[model samples]
Target: MLSIILLAVALSIDACIVAFSYSLTLNKNLIKNAFIFSFSSAFFQAFMPIVGFFIMYYFGLKFIELAKKIDHFIVFFIFLFLGIKIIKDAFKNETIQIEKNLSFKIVFSLSVATSLDALAAGVLIFSSKLDILDCIFIIFVITFVLCFMSFCIAKSIKLNIKLLQIISAIIIILIGFKILIEHTIKHI
Candidate 1:
Protein backbone atom coordinates (compact mmCIF):
# COMPACT_ATOMS: atom_id res chain seq x y z
CA MET A 1 0.00 0.00 0.00
CA LEU A 2 2.77 2.40 0.95
CA SER A 3 4.69 1.47 -2.14
CA ILE A 4 1.69 2.21 -4.29
CA ILE A 5 1.36 5.66 -2.81
CA LEU A 6 5.04 6.27 -3.41
CA LEU A 7 4.65 5.19 -6.98
CA ALA A 8 1.78 7.62 -7.42
CA VAL A 9 3.84 10.46 -6.02
CA ALA A 10 6.76 9.58 -8.25
CA LEU A 11 4.66 9.54 -11.39
CA SER A 12 2.88 12.76 -10.52
CA ILE A 13 6.10 14.66 -10.03
CA ASP A 14 6.31 15.05 -13.78
CA ALA A 15 3.01 16.90 -13.78
CA CYS A 16 4.21 19.15 -10.97
CA ILE A 17 7.40 20.01 -12.80
CA VAL A 18 5.67 20.79 -16.06
CA ALA A 19 2.99 22.85 -14.33
CA PHE A 20 5.74 24.92 -12.75
CA SER A 21 7.17 25.52 -16.20
CA TYR A 22 3.78 26.52 -17.54
CA SER A 23 3.30 28.96 -14.69
CA LEU A 24 6.51 30.69 -15.65
CA THR A 25 5.22 31.30 -19.16
CA LEU A 26 1.78 32.62 -18.24
CA ASN A 27 1.21 36.28 -19.10
CA LYS A 28 -2.50 36.60 -18.41
CA ASN A 29 -5.14 34.61 -16.55
CA LEU A 30 -2.18 33.10 -14.81
CA ILE A 31 -4.07 31.32 -12.04
CA LYS A 32 -7.06 30.39 -14.18
CA ASN A 33 -5.05 28.96 -17.02
CA ALA A 34 -2.59 27.26 -14.73
CA PHE A 35 -5.37 25.28 -13.06
CA ILE A 36 -6.84 24.44 -16.43
CA PHE A 37 -3.56 23.07 -17.61
CA SER A 38 -2.91 21.32 -14.32
CA PHE A 39 -6.28 19.57 -14.33
CA SER A 40 -5.76 18.36 -17.86
CA SER A 41 -2.27 17.28 -16.99
CA ALA A 42 -3.66 15.27 -14.10
CA PHE A 43 -6.28 13.73 -16.36
CA PHE A 44 -3.69 12.60 -18.88
CA GLN A 45 -1.36 11.38 -16.17
CA ALA A 46 -4.20 9.23 -14.89
CA PHE A 47 -5.48 8.23 -18.31
CA MET A 48 -2.13 7.11 -19.77
CA PRO A 49 -1.71 4.35 -17.21
CA ILE A 50 -5.18 2.91 -17.93
CA VAL A 51 -4.43 2.94 -21.61
CA GLY A 52 -1.17 1.17 -20.88
CA PHE A 53 -2.72 -1.25 -18.43
CA PHE A 54 -5.61 -2.11 -20.74
CA ILE A 55 -3.31 -2.53 -23.68
CA MET A 56 -1.19 -4.99 -21.77
CA TYR A 57 -4.21 -6.64 -20.16
CA TYR A 58 -6.05 -7.34 -23.42
CA PHE A 59 -3.30 -7.51 -26.01
CA GLY A 60 -0.13 -8.56 -24.12
CA LEU A 61 2.94 -7.23 -22.39
CA LYS A 62 5.16 -7.94 -25.37
CA PHE A 63 3.75 -4.98 -27.27
CA ILE A 64 4.52 -2.72 -24.34
CA GLU A 65 8.02 -4.11 -24.17
CA LEU A 66 8.47 -3.30 -27.83
CA ALA A 67 7.12 0.22 -27.39
CA LYS A 68 9.31 0.76 -24.34
CA LYS A 69 12.44 0.74 -26.45
CA ILE A 70 11.58 4.01 -28.18
CA ASP A 71 9.57 5.63 -25.39
CA HIS A 72 12.38 7.71 -23.98
CA PHE A 73 13.47 8.79 -27.41
CA ILE A 74 9.98 10.08 -28.09
CA VAL A 75 9.78 11.91 -24.76
CA PHE A 76 13.24 13.40 -25.20
CA PHE A 77 12.35 14.77 -28.59
CA ILE A 78 9.09 16.27 -27.36
CA PHE A 79 10.66 18.03 -24.40
CA LEU A 80 13.70 19.03 -26.39
CA PHE A 81 11.50 20.58 -29.05
CA LEU A 82 9.40 22.41 -26.48
CA GLY A 83 12.47 23.62 -24.59
CA ILE A 84 14.20 24.82 -27.71
CA LYS A 85 11.09 26.58 -28.88
CA ILE A 86 10.67 28.37 -25.54
CA ILE A 87 14.31 29.39 -25.49
CA LYS A 88 14.15 30.62 -29.06
CA ASP A 89 11.08 32.68 -28.28
CA ALA A 90 12.87 34.17 -25.29
CA PHE A 91 15.81 35.15 -27.44
CA LYS A 92 13.66 36.72 -30.10
CA ASN A 93 13.68 40.49 -30.70
CA GLU A 94 10.66 40.96 -28.45
CA THR A 95 12.69 39.60 -25.49
CA ILE A 96 9.79 37.35 -24.47
CA GLN A 97 6.25 37.16 -25.72
CA ILE A 98 3.77 34.93 -23.97
CA GLU A 99 1.26 33.87 -26.54
CA LYS A 100 -2.10 32.77 -25.15
CA ASN A 101 -2.18 29.68 -27.27
CA LEU A 102 -3.09 27.31 -24.48
CA SER A 103 -4.81 24.90 -26.78
CA PHE A 104 -6.01 21.45 -25.76
CA LYS A 105 -3.62 19.81 -28.21
CA ILE A 106 -0.60 21.49 -26.61
CA VAL A 107 -1.74 20.45 -23.14
CA PHE A 108 -2.30 16.93 -24.40
CA SER A 109 1.20 16.80 -25.84
CA LEU A 110 2.77 17.91 -22.58
CA SER A 111 0.68 15.45 -20.59
CA VAL A 112 1.54 12.55 -22.88
CA ALA A 113 5.23 13.35 -22.80
CA THR A 114 5.27 13.69 -19.03
CA SER A 115 3.23 10.56 -18.37
CA LEU A 116 5.36 8.11 -20.36
CA ASP A 117 6.85 6.83 -17.15
CA ALA A 118 3.39 6.42 -15.66
CA LEU A 119 2.31 4.31 -18.61
CA ALA A 120 5.24 1.96 -18.25
CA ALA A 121 4.82 1.76 -14.52
CA GLY A 122 1.15 1.02 -14.93
CA VAL A 123 1.88 -1.89 -17.21
CA LEU A 124 4.30 -3.36 -14.72
CA ILE A 125 1.96 -2.91 -11.78
CA PHE A 126 -1.12 -4.15 -13.58
CA SER A 127 0.70 -7.28 -14.74
CA SER A 128 0.92 -8.27 -11.11
CA LYS A 129 -2.10 -9.02 -8.87
CA LEU A 130 -2.20 -5.54 -7.40
CA ASP A 131 -5.36 -3.40 -7.32
CA ILE A 132 -4.96 -1.39 -10.52
CA LEU A 133 -7.92 0.84 -9.71
CA ASP A 134 -6.41 1.91 -6.42
CA CYS A 135 -3.17 2.82 -8.08
CA ILE A 136 -5.02 4.79 -10.71
CA PHE A 137 -6.96 6.83 -8.18
CA ILE A 138 -3.86 7.55 -6.13
CA ILE A 139 -2.02 8.65 -9.23
CA PHE A 140 -4.83 11.00 -10.22
CA VAL A 141 -5.10 12.73 -6.85
CA ILE A 142 -1.37 13.06 -6.35
CA THR A 143 -0.92 14.46 -9.82
CA PHE A 144 -3.78 16.88 -9.40
CA VAL A 145 -2.59 18.26 -6.06
CA LEU A 146 1.06 18.48 -7.00
CA CYS A 147 0.35 20.13 -10.31
CA PHE A 148 -1.92 22.72 -8.71
CA MET A 149 0.56 23.44 -5.96
CA SER A 150 3.52 23.71 -8.27
CA PHE A 151 1.72 26.14 -10.55
CA CYS A 152 0.59 28.26 -7.62
CA ILE A 153 4.11 28.46 -6.29
CA ALA A 154 5.48 29.58 -9.64
CA LYS A 155 2.66 32.03 -10.22
CA SER A 156 3.21 33.70 -6.85
CA ILE A 157 6.70 34.75 -7.77
CA LYS A 158 7.22 37.85 -9.85
CA LEU A 159 10.13 36.83 -11.98
CA ASN A 160 11.70 38.99 -14.60
CA ILE A 161 10.03 38.25 -17.92
CA LYS A 162 13.16 37.14 -19.72
CA LEU A 163 14.57 35.34 -16.73
CA LEU A 164 11.38 33.34 -16.31
CA GLN A 165 11.45 32.29 -19.93
CA ILE A 166 15.10 31.29 -19.78
CA ILE A 167 14.67 29.35 -16.57
CA SER A 168 11.61 27.53 -17.80
CA ALA A 169 13.36 26.63 -21.05
CA ILE A 170 16.45 25.32 -19.31
CA ILE A 171 14.43 23.32 -16.79
CA ILE A 172 12.48 21.63 -19.57
CA ILE A 173 15.63 20.90 -21.56
CA LEU A 174 17.39 19.51 -18.52
CA ILE A 175 14.42 17.26 -17.78
CA GLY A 176 14.58 15.94 -21.33
CA PHE A 177 18.29 15.27 -21.00
CA LYS A 178 17.67 13.58 -17.67
CA ILE A 179 15.06 11.31 -19.21
CA LEU A 180 17.39 10.44 -22.06
CA ILE A 181 20.26 9.58 -19.72
CA GLU A 182 18.11 7.59 -17.29
CA HIS A 183 16.54 5.47 -20.03
CA THR A 184 19.84 4.97 -21.84
CA ILE A 185 21.46 3.73 -18.67
CA LYS A 186 18.53 1.42 -17.94
CA HIS A 187 18.77 0.02 -21.47
CA ILE A 188 22.50 -0.54 -21.14
Candidate 2:
Protein backbone atom coordinates (compact mmCIF):
# COMPACT_ATOMS: atom_id res chain seq x y z
CA MET A 1 0.00 0.00 0.00
CA LEU A 2 2.75 2.44 0.84
CA SER A 3 4.72 1.37 -2.19
CA ILE A 4 1.74 1.99 -4.42
CA ILE A 5 1.27 5.51 -3.03
CA LEU A 6 4.94 6.36 -3.33
CA LEU A 7 5.10 5.07 -6.87
CA ALA A 8 1.98 6.98 -7.80
CA VAL A 9 3.34 10.20 -6.34
CA ALA A 10 6.68 9.72 -8.06
CA LEU A 11 5.09 8.92 -11.38
CA SER A 12 2.62 11.81 -11.19
CA ILE A 13 5.35 14.39 -10.69
CA ASP A 14 6.00 14.58 -14.41
CA ALA A 15 2.41 15.50 -15.15
CA CYS A 16 2.42 18.08 -12.40
CA ILE A 17 5.55 19.62 -13.82
CA VAL A 18 4.02 19.85 -17.26
CA ALA A 19 0.83 21.28 -15.83
CA PHE A 20 2.83 23.84 -13.96
CA SER A 21 4.71 24.75 -17.10
CA TYR A 22 1.56 25.21 -19.14
CA SER A 23 -0.19 27.12 -16.44
CA LEU A 24 2.37 29.88 -16.64
CA THR A 25 1.65 30.55 -20.30
CA LEU A 26 -2.08 30.11 -20.32
CA ASN A 27 -3.91 33.38 -19.84
CA LYS A 28 -7.47 32.49 -20.81
CA ASN A 29 -9.93 29.65 -20.34
CA LEU A 30 -8.05 28.44 -17.30
CA ILE A 31 -10.76 26.04 -16.26
CA LYS A 32 -10.93 24.36 -19.64
CA ASN A 33 -7.19 24.03 -19.95
CA ALA A 34 -6.88 22.63 -16.46
CA PHE A 35 -9.62 20.10 -17.07
CA ILE A 36 -8.18 19.00 -20.37
CA PHE A 37 -4.69 18.67 -19.02
CA SER A 38 -5.78 17.01 -15.80
CA PHE A 39 -8.12 14.52 -17.45
CA SER A 40 -5.71 13.65 -20.22
CA SER A 41 -2.90 13.19 -17.74
CA ALA A 42 -4.96 11.10 -15.33
CA PHE A 43 -6.37 8.86 -18.04
CA PHE A 44 -3.00 8.04 -19.58
CA GLN A 45 -1.30 7.83 -16.24
CA ALA A 46 -3.83 5.20 -15.14
CA PHE A 47 -4.21 3.37 -18.46
CA MET A 48 -0.53 2.96 -19.34
CA PRO A 49 0.24 1.03 -16.16
CA ILE A 50 -2.44 -1.50 -16.99
CA VAL A 51 -0.98 -1.85 -20.44
CA GLY A 52 2.48 -2.36 -19.03
CA PHE A 53 1.17 -4.72 -16.40
CA PHE A 54 -0.56 -6.83 -19.05
CA ILE A 55 2.45 -6.73 -21.32
CA MET A 56 4.60 -8.21 -18.61
CA TYR A 57 1.83 -10.40 -17.30
CA TYR A 58 1.23 -12.05 -20.67
CA PHE A 59 4.75 -12.20 -22.06
CA GLY A 60 6.53 -12.87 -18.85
CA LEU A 61 4.07 -15.45 -17.55
CA LYS A 62 6.06 -18.31 -19.00
CA PHE A 63 9.13 -17.04 -17.23
CA ILE A 64 7.34 -16.22 -13.97
CA GLU A 65 9.15 -18.82 -11.90
CA LEU A 66 12.49 -17.78 -13.30
CA ALA A 67 11.65 -14.09 -13.04
CA LYS A 68 10.67 -14.33 -9.38
CA LYS A 69 14.33 -14.94 -8.67
CA ILE A 70 15.41 -11.59 -10.16
CA ASP A 71 12.31 -9.45 -10.23
CA HIS A 72 13.77 -7.12 -7.65
CA PHE A 73 16.79 -6.51 -9.82
CA ILE A 74 14.54 -5.77 -12.76
CA VAL A 75 12.51 -3.31 -10.74
CA PHE A 76 15.61 -1.68 -9.31
CA PHE A 77 17.30 -1.19 -12.64
CA ILE A 78 14.18 0.18 -14.27
CA PHE A 79 13.54 2.64 -11.47
CA LEU A 80 17.20 3.63 -11.32
CA PHE A 81 17.31 4.20 -15.04
CA LEU A 82 14.14 6.28 -14.93
CA GLY A 83 15.36 8.27 -11.95
CA ILE A 84 18.65 9.03 -13.66
CA LYS A 85 16.83 9.95 -16.84
CA ILE A 86 14.63 12.40 -15.01
CA ILE A 87 17.62 14.00 -13.33
CA LYS A 88 19.46 14.17 -16.62
CA ASP A 89 16.53 15.75 -18.39
CA ALA A 90 16.08 18.25 -15.61
CA PHE A 91 19.58 19.57 -16.08
CA LYS A 92 19.11 20.13 -19.78
CA ASN A 93 17.19 23.35 -18.98
CA GLU A 94 14.95 22.97 -21.94
CA THR A 95 12.47 25.79 -22.36
CA ILE A 96 8.82 24.81 -22.59
CA GLN A 97 7.17 27.05 -25.18
CA ILE A 98 3.55 26.44 -25.97
CA GLU A 99 0.95 28.54 -27.75
CA LYS A 100 -1.75 30.16 -25.72
CA ASN A 101 -4.30 28.43 -27.89
CA LEU A 102 -4.75 25.10 -26.16
CA SER A 103 -5.98 22.14 -28.12
CA PHE A 104 -6.94 18.61 -27.25
CA LYS A 105 -4.22 17.38 -29.54
CA ILE A 106 -1.52 19.33 -27.76
CA VAL A 107 -2.60 18.40 -24.25
CA PHE A 108 -3.11 14.78 -25.25
CA SER A 109 0.34 14.60 -26.76
CA LEU A 110 1.98 16.04 -23.69
CA SER A 111 -0.05 13.77 -21.45
CA VAL A 112 1.13 10.72 -23.36
CA ALA A 113 4.72 11.88 -23.22
CA THR A 114 4.63 12.65 -19.50
CA SER A 115 2.93 9.33 -18.66
CA LEU A 116 5.44 7.14 -20.48
CA ASP A 117 7.30 6.60 -17.24
CA ALA A 118 4.15 5.32 -15.64
CA LEU A 119 3.99 2.63 -18.29
CA ALA A 120 7.45 1.46 -17.34
CA ALA A 121 6.45 1.68 -13.70
CA GLY A 122 3.63 -0.77 -14.27
CA VAL A 123 6.04 -3.69 -14.34
CA LEU A 124 7.05 -2.90 -10.79
CA ILE A 125 3.44 -3.33 -9.69
CA PHE A 126 3.65 -7.06 -10.20
CA SER A 127 6.20 -7.21 -7.39
CA SER A 128 3.82 -5.49 -4.98
CA LYS A 129 1.09 -7.10 -2.89
CA LEU A 130 -1.72 -4.74 -3.93
CA ASP A 131 -4.25 -5.43 -6.65
CA ILE A 132 -3.76 -3.78 -10.03
CA LEU A 133 -7.10 -2.01 -9.81
CA ASP A 134 -6.17 -0.54 -6.46
CA CYS A 135 -2.93 0.73 -7.91
CA ILE A 136 -4.75 2.23 -10.86
CA PHE A 137 -7.25 4.04 -8.69
CA ILE A 138 -4.54 5.45 -6.49
CA ILE A 139 -2.52 6.60 -9.47
CA PHE A 140 -5.49 8.21 -11.17
CA VAL A 141 -6.63 10.02 -8.08
CA ILE A 142 -3.22 11.25 -7.03
CA THR A 143 -2.27 12.39 -10.53
CA PHE A 144 -5.54 14.22 -11.06
CA VAL A 145 -5.36 15.90 -7.70
CA LEU A 146 -1.74 16.92 -8.08
CA CYS A 147 -2.16 18.27 -11.60
CA PHE A 148 -5.22 20.29 -10.66
CA MET A 149 -3.41 21.66 -7.65
CA SER A 150 -0.36 22.45 -9.75
CA PHE A 151 -2.40 24.66 -12.05
CA CYS A 152 -3.94 26.43 -9.10
CA ILE A 153 -0.58 26.85 -7.44
CA ALA A 154 1.18 27.98 -10.59
CA LYS A 155 -1.15 30.91 -10.90
CA SER A 156 0.28 32.55 -7.79
CA ILE A 157 3.86 31.47 -7.33
CA LYS A 158 6.95 30.29 -9.14
CA LEU A 159 8.37 26.86 -8.30
CA ASN A 160 11.85 25.64 -9.07
CA ILE A 161 11.36 23.13 -11.83
CA LYS A 162 14.82 21.67 -11.50
CA LEU A 163 14.43 21.31 -7.77
CA LEU A 164 11.15 19.49 -8.07
CA GLN A 165 12.57 17.12 -10.64
CA ILE A 166 15.61 16.41 -8.53
CA ILE A 167 13.51 15.64 -5.48
CA SER A 168 11.23 13.39 -7.47
CA ALA A 169 14.24 11.58 -8.94
CA ILE A 170 15.64 10.99 -5.48
CA ILE A 171 12.34 9.58 -4.29
CA ILE A 172 12.27 7.13 -7.16
CA ILE A 173 15.87 6.12 -6.66
CA LEU A 174 15.33 5.61 -2.94
CA ILE A 175 12.31 3.47 -3.61
CA GLY A 176 14.39 1.37 -5.95
CA PHE A 177 17.05 0.96 -3.29
CA LYS A 178 14.41 0.06 -0.72
CA ILE A 179 13.05 -2.70 -2.90
CA LEU A 180 16.49 -4.01 -3.74
CA ILE A 181 17.56 -4.05 -0.10
CA GLU A 182 14.36 -5.74 1.03
CA HIS A 183 14.71 -8.54 -1.47
CA THR A 184 18.42 -8.97 -0.82
CA ILE A 185 17.85 -9.30 2.92
CA LYS A 186 15.07 -11.84 2.37
CA HIS A 187 17.21 -13.92 0.04
CA ILE A 188 20.08 -13.90 2.51
- Which has the greatest lDDT? 1
Q: Where does model 1 exceed 4 Å of error?
A: none
Q: How would you encode candidate 2's per-residue C-alpha lDDT over 45-147 as one tens digit per residue?
A: 9998887788777886554335445756865775677567667766765762224555676577567666766765677786554588999999999999999
- CA lDDT, every model vs. true structure: 0.81, 0.72
Candidate 2, which ten residues in sequence have the lowest lDDT sum?
93-102
**After TM-score superposition, what is the CA distance of residue 134 in candidate 1 from its true location, in Å?**
2.3
- TM-score against native, each model: 0.92, 0.62
- Candidate 2, superposed: residue stretches over 4 Å from native: 61-101, 157-188
Worst 10 residues of 1 by lDDT: 94-103
Which tens-of-lDDT digit does each residue in 1-188 have in candidate 1?
A: 78878888888887788888867877787667777877787787777888888888888878788777888899899888888888888888765678564667668878889988887766867777678778788888888888889988987888697889889878888888999999899889
On TM-score, the candidate that comes out on top is 1
